[model samples]
Target: MDRTILKSQLERYRTPYEEESAFIDSFIDLTSDPLAYKRERLEGHFTASAWIVNRRRTHTLLTLHRKLGRWLQLGGHADGDENLIEVAMKEAKEESGLTSLDLVDSTIFDLDKHIIPERPHVPEHYHFDVRYILEADINEPLHISDESISLAWITFDSVVDMIGYNPSILRMLEKTSKSEILL
Candidate 1:
């Protein structure tokens, strides 16, 4: 969970998206602050999420985020855990109610920096999200958590149409596609 280790991982990651590559650089710069993982730090905080695909790799699990009301991947604040892979798995299991999940790859599948609108007592800030891929049986029952309004498994072809696609998500999808071929 060391920032140095995370920084090394980010530095080694190669992506076609220049913005994401820049984000990695920015994230590396922020690692100098030891408190980067704290939600209250305000400058920005590390968030982790799962790009969960089914065993068949035909569909991905998405949640209708309760607060944002948007179809998005399952994840949340790092909450002091610097091991982003663990954070992603923990959030995915908690939000999706899936007991069995296997990491598709130990390396990061995607990275995104997005503005989180101010809510209640919290001011506006950025979320430097590190995304990992996980796989589960498509037939597994999903018990939606209070964090989400609903959960659905969206096919790869329909993702963009369903969620008004974000480029980051598309990048993750493309990365997963390539990984699938390698596997």
Candidate 2:
């Protein structure tokens, strides 16, 4: 998979949180591996997500993940695709049925490494997730894909109450709140 674009983006990303310095560094290093973006790598693989917000930036979309049974941002495995921005856009459209999505920024918005529990055939592995901020018209109708049980636009203030203190979610929210575009 081509990684130059991903490497360039990662190199340009600067985390706001001091504690995330290591995570960013580690993610950059992961890009060095030729197979790092492949799902078959096992150790971990790249996944892209959309932190989809409404035109007003007041509400962010969340999907009730079918497999994980949790309300989380819309995303999926790279499946050998190297361009994560494209992956994120495709996933957002596929998962949410919103075709008018617009990328708020092309750079990485957040990076997270989380473990995927072992399934019957798929062994436990880590997902090195890359998140991007995207905007869409909230008035557009939403069609739930098979990947999600339901999809909803959750207000920023109510996300924590719904997800219960997930650090990644909080960090994304904090970033969004502080973003100049929202000012």
Minimum summed lDDT over a 10-residue window in model 2 is located at: 16-25
lDDT of each: 0.88, 0.89
Per-candidate TM-scores read 0.95, 0.95
Name the candidate that leads on lDDT: 2
Tens digits of per-residue lDDT, candidate 2, 1-183, equal 258888878888888676555677778888998888898898888999999999887999999999999989999988888889999999999999998899988878888888899998889998999999999999999999999999999998899998886788888899999988655
RMSD of each: 1.3, 1.4
The segments of candidate 1 whose C-alpha lies over 4 angstroms from its true place after superposition are: 180-182
Clash pairs (backbone) in predicted model 1: none
lDDT of 1 by residue, 36-58 (tens): 88897897899999999988889
